[model samples]
Target: MAKTIAVEYRVHDGPDALAHAAAEHFLEQAQKSVAAKGKARIAVSGGSTPKRTFELLANPKEKFLQAMPWEKLELYFVDERTVPPTDKDSNYRMTREAMLDKVPLKPEQVFRIKGELPPEEAAARYESTLRNQFKLEGAEVPRFDVLALGMGDDGHTASIFPHTAGIHELARLVYANQVPQKDTWRVTLTWPVIIQAGEVFFLIGGKDKADPLHRVLQGQYDPETLPSQLIQPKNGKLLFLLDKDAAALLPAPDASGKGKLEIQR
Candidate 1:
């Protein structure tokens, strides 16, 4: 049964402010997770918004670079384009150029989906990797300390395009979805795996996203037409870091730039 999920959002003045907010949130979550356990397992998505956040985290001039516990963090991808790591569209490549090469994190600490392989093969390999890393004995799912996501203008999230087979995938931790709209295959963590994460948040910006974002949060619970709606974390809360353009259609934030809503998942 679907339960009520508390939707919290913080509206930033612009893209730069939004990116800074996201980077700070990332650092805070990582610190909390590491304090709770010995290490933090975080999965991140790829997009322009996240790219800026990654740059901020990796910049030596930024506080995150000096404060982040690099050795105690294990990074993973939430999704990847079905292209080689060297490709322009490869999420791993973007991360490497923006953050990985500059950060103190070792190569082994980053687990990238091998997008160069066949889509199904890549998905299977990633699933096996997760099982081994998390030491899963059976049907248990790996729980990430934090999962960062991005919503597409079309209302898709983590490569789970609207009405795609990825939306119906419940048995697997990873899936190779064929996105007909984009005419490409994508390797992604399934929605079940995503919702199991300890913290789940979306970073969204641009005026183009305003309409779909409105529909995704305020419209009916229709996963087929708006796959972003599928991201209702089991913890009963979700967060959105938005720029003013993206949050235009949503409720106005308080003086502190915070807004809240509740919806049945």
Candidate 2:
């Protein structure tokens, strides 16, 4: 199955600016989806880079609260630690404190993985939740309107760590990925489901991310070695939002100073 990958790169002056750009892009996408479908499904990733963006979305500044159609937005986590939701490390907890608590969504509108459960059971429960909420027909993967992802320094996304089982998964929509190096497990949406999104945004920043971002963009396509490189939306948009620090290692930009936004067919 040959697919064309269109990537858009938008670099900002700093982390705060980068977060603002991401928030604006998210708002545009959410509004578009809600207008077309009466609802928006978004799967968000957890990481320091995304925290600022989530917070910006929740804050009332610039009439953001009024601008966003929160009632029509359903939030889901792309991945979660095996710890309970109350844990500080839990993605759900971070999202709640940063955005969900301030949003206008009902409890039923938020689908969170039960990290307290066994990893496999947690994954199954989340998959079932997706099927029921999205009214997915048999063999139909949940297609999110927006899938916001974070890239790790190792080029991993959504707990699909380098050389992990999650990267190799093709049949399953969700699964528990074990990282023996950390002696822990995490529940994540597998590549099959992720690539079904209408839009996938990789919000990345910081100098530490420079090397991996460069590798994922410029290096060979090796999902097993660099899980982030695996993301290729079959019929959707792939956007990479980077701060200047993260874009520093890429090749020099043209006179317009915009970093490269390559589209590979």
Best by TM-score: 1
- The worst-scoring run of ten residues by lDDT in candidate 2 lies at 256-265
* Model 1 TM-score (2 dp): 0.99
Tens-place lDDT digits, model 1, residues 1-265: 7599999999999999999999999999999999999899999999999999999999989999999999999999999999999999999999999999999999999999999999999999999999999999789999999999999988999999998999999999999999999999999999999999999999999999999999999998799989999998999999999999999999999999999999976
Model 2, CA-based lDDT? 0.87
Per-residue lDDT value at 17 in model 1? 100
Instruction: Return the TM-score for candidate 2, rounded to 2 decimals.
Output: 0.95
Residue 177 displacement in candidate 1 (angstroms) = 0.3
Q: Residue pairs in steric clash, candidate 1?
A: none
By lDDT, who's the top model here? 1
lDDT to native, each model = 0.96, 0.87
